[model samples]
Target: MKNVEIYIKSTCSFCVKAKNLLKQNNIKFKEIFVENSTANLSKMIKRSKKTTVPQIFINKVHIGGYEDLIIFLKKNI
Candidate 1:
């Protein structure tokens, strides 16, 4: 199983969707909330090269946001 990490904001619909999909698939993940802290947001941008909610990583590989995650899951699963 791949180690998963997701950066999210609580109110983001895409973030909710991404988490739900992970749960449905039984994929355990670490959730990093970037809602309030500038430092956490900066970290996500530095890692993902994206300033979007639901930035995801699998085993330290950048898998992009929610749409990209779906594509990756489809291919891998």
Candidate 2:
């Protein structure tokens, strides 16, 4: 498996769902929490060009948010 990274905000339901999905698929991911730090959130926006939690990446390539992750999983997982 490729390196999976997920940027998540605390208390975000979509983030939980996304992590759950990954776990169900037995995918190990690095969880980046951006709920308390501005720098992390800013980095997420800079990388994804979107101000949203649960921003996912695979091997340094942007895989987008929750629904996008689902699609990617369906096609490639």
Candidate 3:
């Protein structure tokens, strides 16, 4: 089983898309909702260097947002 983490915002459409993609792939993931929590958002930005919602990590390595995640999945899957 692969370790997957998704840093998401509740209002982000991209986040929804990303999550749907994961569901379609039958992937299990841990989701961190960064809503009204500066500390959590800060942590995600620090780790990913990205301010976008749906920042993804697989096996603890940052894979970026939705588009990047799709590309990574295409390459790996």
Candidate 4:
């Protein structure tokens, strides 16, 4: 498995769902809460160019949000 990171806001249902999916699949991930930190949010935006809640990355490549992650899992997992 590749190194995975997910940029998320705490209150976002999509973020929760995404994390849950990763957990269910036994995929370890590093999660950063964008709501609690400005620097991380800034980095997320710089990297993804989006203000969405759950910006996911796999192996340093942006994989988009929850739905995209699901699709990626279907193909990779």
How many steric overlaps are in each model, in order?
0, 0, 0, 0
lDDT for model 2 comes to 0.93
As a TM-score, model 3 comes out at 0.94
In model 1, where is the ten-residue run with the lowest total lDDT?
1-10
What does candidate 3's lDDT look like per residue over 1-77, in tens digits? 39999999889999999999999999999999888889989999999998889899999999999999889889988
Candidates ranked, most accurate by TM-score first: 4, 2, 1, 3
Ten contiguous residues with the weakest lDDT in model 3: 1-10
Ranking by lDDT: 4, 2, 1, 3
Better candidate by TM-score, 1 or 4 = 4
- lDDT of model 4 at position 45: 97
Cand. 1 TM to true fold: 0.95
Greater-lDDT candidate between 1 and 4 = 4
- Any runs in candidate 1 off by more than 4 Å, and if so which? none
Q: Write one digit per residue (lDDT tens) for candidate 4, span 17-62.
A: 9999999999999999899899999999999999997999999999
User: In angstroms, how far off is 25's CA in candidate 3?
Assistant: 0.5
Cα error of candidate 1 at position 50, Å: 0.6
Candidate 1 steric clashes? 0
Question: Model 1, residue 61: what's the lDDT?
Answer: 96
The 10-residue segment of model 4 with minimum total lDDT is 1-10
Clashing pairs in 2: none
Candidate with the larger TM-score of 1 and 3? 1
